[model samples]
Target chain A: MASTVSEVAEVTRPEQVALRSSLWHEAFLRLKKKRLAMVGLVFLLVMAVVCFIGPFFSPYASGKINTAMINKPPSFSHWLGTDSLGRDILTRLMQAGRISLTVGIASMVLSVSIGALLGALAGFYRGWVDQVIMRVADVLMTIPGLPLLFIMGAVLSEWKIPTDYRIYIVMVMLSLIGWPGLARMVRSQMLTLRESEFMQAAEVLGLRDRRKLFFHLLPNLTPLLIVVATLNVGGAILSESVLSYFGLGVVPPTPTWGNMMDAANTLIDFQKRPWLWVPPGIAIFATVISINLLGDGLRDALDPKQKR
Target chain B: MNALVEIQNLSTYFKSEQGVVKAVDALELRVHEGETVCIVGESGCGKSAAAMSLMRLIPEAVGSIVSGEIWFAGRDLRKVSKEEMRKLRGNELAMIFQEPMSSLNPVLTIGEQIMEPIMEHQGLSKKAAQARAIELIELVGIPRAKEIAKSYPYELSGGMLQRIMIAIAISCNPRLLIADEPTTALDVTIQAQILDLLRKIKDEAQTAILFITHDLGVVAEMADHVVVMYAGKVVEVSPVVELFEEPKHPYTQGLLRSKPVLNQRRAKLYSIPGQVPNPTTLGESCYFHDRCDQCLDICRVKQPPLRDGGDGRKVACWLYEEESVRGQ
Candidate 1:
């Protein structure tokens, strides 16, 4: 009976607080109260900040080979221990994170741009334009996605794709395939909202069609777009990792999580050494979970159906 | 006062899956300066279509004003470029739609929506526009004008939102205001309030109003001159008093009699039997011939042109042709 009273008190307290907050503010408060999501957010933020700031303050350069402390275990001197090639796991993880996060952000931007543009146009114009765009989307969806990514990567590599230019190529390919789903969703939403009074009001106000589409219609899509992009970044990062694991993405010495895992596969001397697998595995899991949590938080925040 | 808006021989046809529907066929009407003209018709009678054509707002792909001369503010609107039409929309003339709840931008604050016209047409400063918005809100009888200006359309009540819409429409102070069924969706008391507000606003602003509605009670309350439409054509037009006292067109008389009055009680409420003829199937004969009472034999064979009644009124019926001939 006492516990039931306490539970009621717990639920009632937040509702009182929620009444005082705006939509976004209420979402942020709810997010802050969620332990797993909060932990994920903090972890992602720390990782990003460290990756940005640590490179400038490091004593050892990224390419600098330290042969003396090769394969050292966790100790006072080395917190996460050394890699097979004597490189600091802490430094390597941070450096690798920079590439992973960059690729994740880039691909998300490209995909969202394509998706939003197509979605808005398809929705606004409808009829033939809608039909043609959706048919192309259907064809793309039928193709096995991962296999297509593999084939594209291999073809690009065989054609001597530049090491510096490979990340951009991967981003483009992923974006090209990724936009259809988002576009279809946005198109349906736009169709429903197009007949709404606000659009008619904009027309009557003599706003140019372009301005109406972007300013009035586009802002309404922001929350959904944000949610989709957050979730997609995790998927894109995971896909890139898988490609790199198979030697199709990010060529040698790029310091990626996948490449680190690949190196673990070839380490013959340490049969009992789980040191090499642990760090990279943790890095991948941490990033994916962080992105997913952020996406969930955003969905809750933006959904009009959610209670304040 | 000269005619501020003259729509002569205007025909708007829409291409639908069913066939080409004549939404507005040879609609001729005029709105003189500072006059309150109301167009009354049942649903799908092309009253709204005629209004949209005046603004050149008919969607181009499926719909087109096939032939028309829309003279507005001493210029032919049909000849104007799209850019020029845009300039005319919010600057020279403004329109208030039927559903105020849907017509307002949901994301924008009431102040911003009102200020858009000021910024676009008048080029007022944000601070000045904000001040003007509050003033306009107060003019529309919204209490706490300053605070209400910060609220979104969804946050306000239905009556409050409609008032805000009127505020936006009148912000630029256009010479003409077109209201399409401004009170159709509101409750009875709210409808009265809105109609009263519109009448008061028109008197205060001295702006010529082109009001479109299906409700005869509204026409009685608001119209100075009334145009009666059937199918897609104007069946009768006269001064409000003349229309009520002696309606020449059979359709107009039928419409006036169909209403349930306060002082009269009958076995059943009068109604025009049969549905309005579909525009696609309508021939050159009188559109309302099937349902019109006192239909002459010639009514089914030939359509009647608008004939001037003895008084300052127009009736498109063969019975009024003798008066038309005598006047000529």
Candidate 2:
């Protein structure tokens, strides 16, 4: 009788002999099924390679001035034509891509790191600590981002800061202004996870607060973090371009996408000379759209509830 | 033998928009070293609140242990430092919750989760911990320990996860295990399997268990001593066989009668008459007075205290109080 019972138990049990797919692997497989996101990813990769390496092959330097070639249209000698200073627009655009992409990526990293840390601390330890951090975030969030960025940019330019240091200032300004939204998002996410049974289990297991925060809570926040960071890149790039358009970002000679479009501000230059602004304009539009598409794809892919 | 855990007058309260809720009101219980003591009660009768109060794991912001003395391992748990309490939690005492699916971290593998308490309390190296984890998995009767170890919690069935939870709880050879309805979420067949596993572990390890359940059947099967709680207070305490055969309190009798017996035909199933009193609005009189079928005038105005009945039984009812006084 006992042997038969044991045999029945054995037969009823489903075989778990095959290795199970990990969470990340499942998310990756889901992500691959998204066609638009794949296209966005490919476009971003190609843009990155073009920006980083294309400048090396170009004949004209971003700073080079040829008086005779001033305002030349697209021709055999120069692709995308020349600007008012006779500098190659293609070379300047590539250089600007490097700066714009760097600032976007660096600021995103800085803001998300600071935001996620403060948010985790506030959400996990919810009393005076939460009140203080959330109050600060609230105050920052109430201020209009563009107006604040404009004031900071005007002040830096008025101070006659060194051209080299101005890029760093712009990066810092963007990061400082960008973190509040992400902080609040992370705080809300952490608050929901704080009451989950697994977190309570971790506490019962006597794991330290640090281990619970990083190992247990942080892994659950990965999908949210990835989606937020991807979207922030596009926002950061746009902010840098707007700052440079006002002649308050990286000084004129330093070549940023924003400064490259500053020449098109005049009605005459805007209508007649399409070469000066069209390429950079199109580049900005394409990059930002691609990033947003990719962010949406990631959001859908990482959501565990979404069926493949 | 000395009690493994002695909880005296433990009261936990929660603050809410409605008012302060006395979740556990001056609850007292004890567990011997190798015995299984089951706290049986209806839902919202403070079974889980009392269990969490023992470890001081109540949410600090919303709930607080207002007064209590949880004496374990020769020290008052309330007076101990936070660090000391943490060290004692998974080492000397451990808990397994009701919902096995949500209790285990989804991202963590079974082996990693099992090794956590072992590595934390025992300070074993990763390799040694891994080996010990495999042994524990096999001990819990999992067929392919190595394969199961590599899988995440979502990949396993509820029965498998509950067994894994048991393995983790017993990893440090804890002196006491608090299982809060460990098998309630499983099917009947799986429930029987889990109960068998728990009984085997208790005999082999000699670890005292404080089992909390709402099912009388579970209490009958597993308990050495039984505590019946109603509205956050103990109504009766007795030996298991005596509790079933000769219940003293009116509430205990009601509970036993409410259970549907197998192979018995009845036109209608039996259920207790009224709902449990709301915690926040409970008055100065006995909380169960409204629901008691045989209520005296004294039972309405004054609360009955738990008094000793003969043959090691204790009951808190106005009817029993007179008999005890006459004997005294």
Candidate 3:
């Protein structure tokens, strides 16, 4: 074994590369086999591309209104139809997709960062620090999320917050509601992880607390974090729509999926003209269901205990 | 010359919900340079606790070191600063734990895990550390070193993980290696291989080993000296051959009898009746008194001190108390 090692070294290097691509590479392969998740991933990519680029190709790309053509039915000129403002609904739907997807993804990032960090700190430190962070989480959790978001949105509007900054604030609001749950989950997982033998092994290895927390601790929690973050994006989109229906999120002229549905919410449009509400409704539905499918696939794939 | 490591009158206490438990008390041990000292005891008998105390890993959260002096290489470990302790922990004094399955970070590559201490202590660059990690992996006798290093813990068997754990422990060439039941979690075949690997490391590195195990067979195989513990107190300490030839303490005697001999027939194997006493209410008496074959009246109410019985042996049974008086 010892004498042949020098000769074996050359061949071993390439094998090491194959081995290093390990868990994530394995997870990706597993995920590829799950057809529903693949479809979801493909649809989301296509939706993202169309939402970001499709509006630029439209004849009425600028959404210039024509009062005489108000609420026109579907035709070759407009694939979906014209809305109450006589803007092409297909272009508007694509435009709205951009804002909704952005809010979903941005808020997911915000919440996950805040949640995972606070939770890990609480679990690791676990004395007064745990008490303080968990109590705050508990307090936030006791109050209904919708009502609290409503109060914050009402405050944002009452303060005459500018329209351009509202999406950013709405992202912040969604994260504020989202983190408490994620933090609590992370904290509980961290508590169990702290008791794991590797932690004691880390202490013995004399790795600094900072390295232990980030490289050792946080990396282990990535599977949990990824699954939660994807799920959060879906939830964030729905919450933004709910807030938009109440005229609090990304108001008119912004073309958010929520406000588009709000535009056609009256009894006449709901009963007679099915075109307006249906497109934005389908946009929200497709984005959420795909996210859920992909998230579930990731959960199974990344799980260590998951059998083949 | 002074021994490599000397632990004097160490007492560690834990404040559990039930009450205060003396996890390790009146513990005395010495390991010379390159010597292997096997701490033999039943489960929960404070063998692991004593090993952790040497590395300053005991009394971490709910436990406290009530009293002790851990002298290592002319320095008292108990008095060192946290930074000094940390520096000493893996660089000069390293540890290998039981349960290799859970002892390694499941997410990390074996190379990354082993490279951690090499980088931290040796101040090597990442590339240098990776080369050193592969070297250490091969040094521990794992073939296809590069391939093994890149593999995750979950992919390996119990014995292989234990070998990696040993590789990590010896990466910095520590002066004293603590093995806390390192083979307890492996089957017998893997157990022998780990033992062999550890013995080879001890000889090659000239590193002292404080080996903790419940198996007499392991003690007979690896120990230069033996320290027999019962309920957190050292009952006997002797040279390996003398310990087997003329075991002194009643507890030691019972332990020897319990091992089944090869090609011998018996209706039943001898097992010491009862178990290690509960930590919370371990009274001041011979901890082995309840299960001792020849218990004196004094053994019920008065704890026997670990009396030296000449010829580099110490036994904590009242039966040997007269020998201390005669020698004194």
Candidate 4:
């Protein structure tokens, strides 16, 4: 017997168009209407645009600190107030946004690329390859990420690496260590997608494994990878901040959110002048929260099971 | 038509933790140009694996072609570089899948999916490829071709998605189409329509089809030749009519008998006595010996060779010794 849709049309295509027009499109459009997700999208867009443009209009070059304006409070001249070392807080904040957002973006790119590649190979091949890759991932998972980052930073510092390049060193460290969890998630996703009929079809069509992984299998994984990449940016930013708090991030003169908090700890400076902590702290909170919200929204939207 | 695809002693084995899993063992079949050959078996019978091995799609590290020659259009597939194989996918050969819902890229629109192979294989201009995509959509019987071409995978129903997949598969006008249970997920009436669509494509495009399925009904509906697989081995190969009317292999007989007849008043429907042996945990004996109604001591002691019966028919059974001798 024919299906309900099939009864309405003899060929497959018309029935699909009718069914889609009546159901799937409406449901998806309704979900895209979520207020919080849209707000999150706007927030992310603003932050991205502002940061992208921040370096261009920055008042002072990133390295220059004004000695005369040391530790000045918030005013019309210095919107976020001067830091302890007299850099324009606004300039420093913008410059720091460049570093923060770059670290977040770069580390995510590195991690996701490495993670997705390894994960696809592991999950698609399975057996010995899967066992070896997963076991290594398991070992990485057991090691606490923060402590590992600290140790890596200390080792790199002891080696007297270039001070200006310290932040990049930290980013690489975070990516190398951070990839295991994302890799595991990606591996499972690849595992699921590998068994999908599309993948089999690709194989039977004489498509190579690499092409199938890059095209058929990987495209299906976009939603999961997107969510993970967003959250990963948040994670990478936090790692940078934490590393900086311990004096391992972009050397002392360079203003970072973590360095701002680190500077605040001296002589109850933060309590006396509440403005110092608030600006960088708010920046950190705003960026992280918006990314998290975006991730959450995407997770909901891409999920095939969840109804609007 | 000359043979467009030929296989000789193709065996694909996986090195698993438990043991060596032979997913496709000594499978030999041929599909002439514009022919439709059905590789029919229940799940885990390695019909899909045989298809995979032909393309060398199984990962070399985990699974290897222990011994085989897969010649497609007179080229040895095993000797070709991976780059050449990828180029072959949408150019000389393409495939349709069982579940259309999962097969089409969810993020891509129908036009983009159809356009991909045209652009990749044929290097057609954007406008030209898009025009071809629309034509393909119409060719597959999709209505409102322009409008439907703009929709994403999730926007289409199962049957519609299958049609879209058909459009994409036939985009490059490949010579051979390996449709692995192409209509298994579709409704019965949709299955008929899809089978018809496939037959029409085969005739019009002159594309050979390596159809994989377990359904005898689907085989009768579409196949010109039939290969019955049991536990990774091809037990019988014959013209579809002969295979259905006088099947030589016991397993084929069992499979044909297992199909539920129309309005039959029955205490029980016929079924193969045991579940297919898991490939990872297979034994040395005849793959079907444990469940075969005609099992003898020799059947349990050793696997049977796929010996020729007569008139392009082959059977792997001890009972076919006289026919096997005549062929030798």
Candidate 5:
């Protein structure tokens, strides 16, 4: 009874605050109402905190290989157990998570910025500017994404790029593959907004083309960009994992989730060393799924036409 | 009074798949300072095309101003640079659209929307602009001006949105306000309120208004003078009282009669016969000939030139032509 009263108090407090805030608060309130989305958000926050900070507290934080304890199963000393080199898989999973999440987030931001800018330019200035940008996006979109990433990854390995440098390059490569789809979405939205009568009202106000595009046009595309950006994070993480799995991305020395999984790929290791591969696999799956659920919730929450 | 906006031989054309559509063909219009000149017409009669042309807002894909001289306060608008035009617009000349529902940005606060033109045209500081926005919103007769300013467009009623649109339009205190059917989307009481608001603003600001609408009743209430258009051509121009009391051209007569009269219990309302000529195929003959009741033999051959009627009125019909028997 006391907890229920507290819960009601908690919900009403935000509503009171929302009355003083802007429409963003209203959207946030709606977002809070979506159960799956809230759970997804919570899970993502937990995962992020754990991945970014948990590795420091582990006993084997430096990951000095103790080959004597190789292929040990779940036990009190090591929560998940030991890897092929007898490094703590639990500690490595946390470390791998940091790399994977950084790649996902940085690439998503880079691609969303490039995509939205190009899309706005195309939609606002529809003659030659539109044709040039859209055609470039179209050309990029025609090539399949996974194969393109693989080919780029293969080039990095062929050039024998340093493993440390490869993570940054892999982020850039994933963003390169990611932009065309988002650019198309933003452009089509820009085209629709360009036709809206409010835009005509803007023209009449003598607003400069820059003001019209940024203040008027781009602001309207916020919800769509947010949802697309959220979804893109998942795709980026998955792509990075695949790239790393094939021994091309942040390679063996880097301790990425993909490389950890890759280390346990031998026949003997695959049959016996579940701790090596399963933890990283579960982390990748859980993170991507949480992001997708959050994206779905944001789409609903941000849609102004949707009913309460 | 000097002409605030004088449009001479303004022709706007669109290239359709079939042929070139002369949306506003060689149109002539003049609005004196502090006067309300309503352009009355049926649909597809080029009223809006003329308005769009005067604003220089014709989208490259939609259409273009083929030729014309739009003189505003002694400057020929067509000859002005794009930058100068941008400066002139919303500062010296402002416009409000018909659809209040869609005219405002749904995402922005009404306060911010009103402040936009104030900042853009006047270069006022953000704080000053916001204060002026509240004042303007109050001037438009909205209560709780501060609260209203903070509210987004979707939160307002249609009448309120139109009022907010008016506030934004008048923010820069423009010399000319181009109102394209500003009240057509509102209910009767709201329409009257909006019209009153416009009249109040015009009187206060001494601003010239180029009003466009199909409603004769609205023309009667708001227009100081009326320009009747048909098939992309101005058929008549007259003082509003004279327009209501004695319509000159056949098109104007049809428009007045088509409006339903109160207390006249008629089963069927009067309607103009025949359709407006397809813009793609308009010929040399008077475009109204097929639909006009007083069509002369000459109307079937050469088009009638606009003739000066007494009392500063103009009519473009063969009935007023002194050489009435030219074709015969």
Candidate 6:
């Protein structure tokens, strides 16, 4: 038994000394090696810049109604064509990109923050605290998210919530439904971490429960949380798009990618006039794919067992 | 010497799916000020559990102090509130675990980890705590203390991490330090250095240490008093020299005989036969009855109580029970 322990110590000790660097530093170094992830990162950055700045450069406003230019193909004058409402599809797409990205990021932040807190509390305290939080997550997990979102949107619209406020309401709704999975992830991670020697050391040091949870356990969980949050952003964007596509998401005038796709639901538009819908569809697909790639890269990089 | 910590009839049990496991049963031990008391036993002998039970660090979800009175600083530790226990821990009492590599927080800087208990218990300012931490790091013989303080646990070697653990354990100059197989993970040379450091701490601070280990060599080198455990019960208690020269219990005899001497080469190393009894269902008879080569008829029918063998020594065995009765 003693021999086995010393053998393990001998194997682990040298590697630990050789790799005398911070976890973030090692993860960053590993992340740099994955070329596709770097490309995805660059794409996201460029997309962010385009979404934030591209509308300022457009000749036509997102709300402008140019009847003559309506349903125009991808010409130089109306690049990516105009929508059925005579709105410049490119301008509206970029403008809607801002809202979609905002909703995605906002919802991700809200859900992850809530999830991480509940998970940390439940896992660190365990017992009834674990039971209460996890059972709530279990119940929430059973509810179909899309149908719930649809119901929430219908109820909110009936209540006459204004268009701008409804976007926030949609964010809250998505976050409410999105948190259970992330919460479960954080809880399981915290459970393992709570048993780790460092955490016990912290406990033995007479550190307060709050400090141990935040300073010791939470910091160790950052890599997992970051990966979960990144992945959730793509899901959030897709969920918002689906909600809007069904006319239950961000209202028409607000021009989310989901509502924008509402224009191409007709058989004629789906087959003949692909220009009116293809750009928004491609934009959503590209954003979600890039984010997922980045998330996958992060998971690989942050895994401590991964060799250099 | 005054007893700094006294544990009487301490029995710690774990509630598992199978049954209640009596991990430590009717254990009696003490650590005196300026003395080192080593609890020696093989694996699964409950030495570590006994140490953790002293600090009440046992997992409340599964394990508990079934029956015990841990008296420390003139108070029953079992009767103390959790808040009071927290105050006592890392201040009046501190503990160092076996796996040094895993015992320190990887994300936290050494300085931050060391400075925390000082700041928390001593109520020192951050600057003062930082200074105290640096002093501690140097005290543990780590060179370039300032620079080492900024480094994380992963950046340090196992020996260095163990020293850092010592530094942290001794930060508040605790009255009693509980070391649970502290040097087991380290190599022999580093092990000696850490043991020497612990000796230095004991001499300088006059802090009582409850040293728990499986290595009898460590017990000989460090212990003033030695407690030999078997099947969760302490079979013998004697001074270091007495334990080496005259072990009384069969289990203690088996433990000493099983250890290979450096120069006495043999075809096969000596080994004690039979495994430690399953703690949950230990029978009414002597726990060592099956394993003892010299087991008598009465040994198989009844358990032996721990009886004094004079000169501050105690042993629990049917052989000693007869001797005590004859003397009476």
Highest TM-score model number = 5
Predicted structure with the largest DockQ when compared to the true one: 2
Residue lDDT tens for model 3, B1-328? 7899999999988889989888898899999999999999988888988888888887477887889899999999999999999988889999998889999998899999999999999899999999999999888887788888888887776777898999999999999999998988777767888899999988988999999999899999999999998888999999999999999998999999999999999999999998778888888777889999898878888888888777799988788777554343
Give the residue spans of candidate 6 off by over 4 A. A1-21, A59-72, A75-77, A84-86, A266-273, B16-20, B321-328
Accuracy of chain B in candidate 6 (TM-score):
0.97
TM-score of chain B only, all predictions?
0.96, 0.97, 0.96, 0.96, 0.97, 0.97
Better of 3 and 4 by lDDT: 3
Instruction: Using TM-score, rank the candidates from best to worst.
Output: 5, 3, 2, 6, 1, 4
* Model 2 lDDT, residue A298, Cα: 95
User: What is the docking quality class of candidate 4?
Assistant: acceptable
What DockQ would you assign to candidate 6? 0.36
- Return whichever of 1 and 4 wins on DockQ: 4
B1-328 in candidate 1: lDDT tens per residue?
6799998999999999878999998988899887899999999999889888888889887799999899998899999999988988877788888888889877777888898888877889989999999999999887678777776666666667788888888888878888999888776766787888888888888888999999999999999999999988889999999899987888888898899989987999988888888778778788888988787777887888887766879889877776544344
List model 4 lDDT by residue over A77-158, tens digit each.
Answer: 7777887777777777777787888998999999998898888889888989999988998999999988888788888889
Q: How many residue pairs clash in each candidate?
A: 1, 0, 0, 0, 0, 0
List ranges where model 1 is wrong by over 4 Å: A1-23, A26-43, A46-63, A125-177, A246-254, A267-270, A306-308, B263-267, B323-328
Question: How do the residues A180-267 of candidate 5 rate in per-residue lDDT, one tens digit apiece?
Answer: 7888888889989988999989888898999999898898999999999999999989888988898878887678888888956788
Which 10-residue window in model 1 chain B sums to the lowest lDDT? B319-328
RMSD of 5: 5.8
Question: Quick one: how many clashes does candidate 4 have?
Answer: 0
Better structure of 1 and 5 per TM-score: 5
Alpha-carbon lDDT of model 2: 0.89
Candidate 3 residues lying further than 4 Å off, grouped into runs, are: A1-21, A32-35, A266-268, A306-308, B16-19, B59-62, B273-275, B323-328
For every candidate, C-alpha RMSD to the true structure in Å: 6.4, 3.3, 4.0, 5.8, 5.8, 3.7
For residues A1-118, write the lDDT of model 6, one tens digit per residue: 7546754564455355444556678788899999888888899999999989999999886487777766877888878888776778889999999999999999999999999999
Comparing 1 with 6 on DockQ, the higher-scoring candidate is 6
Interface RMSD of 2: 3.1
* Clashing residue pairs in candidate 5 (N, C-alpha, C atoms within 3 angstroms): none
lDDT of each: 0.83, 0.89, 0.89, 0.82, 0.88, 0.88
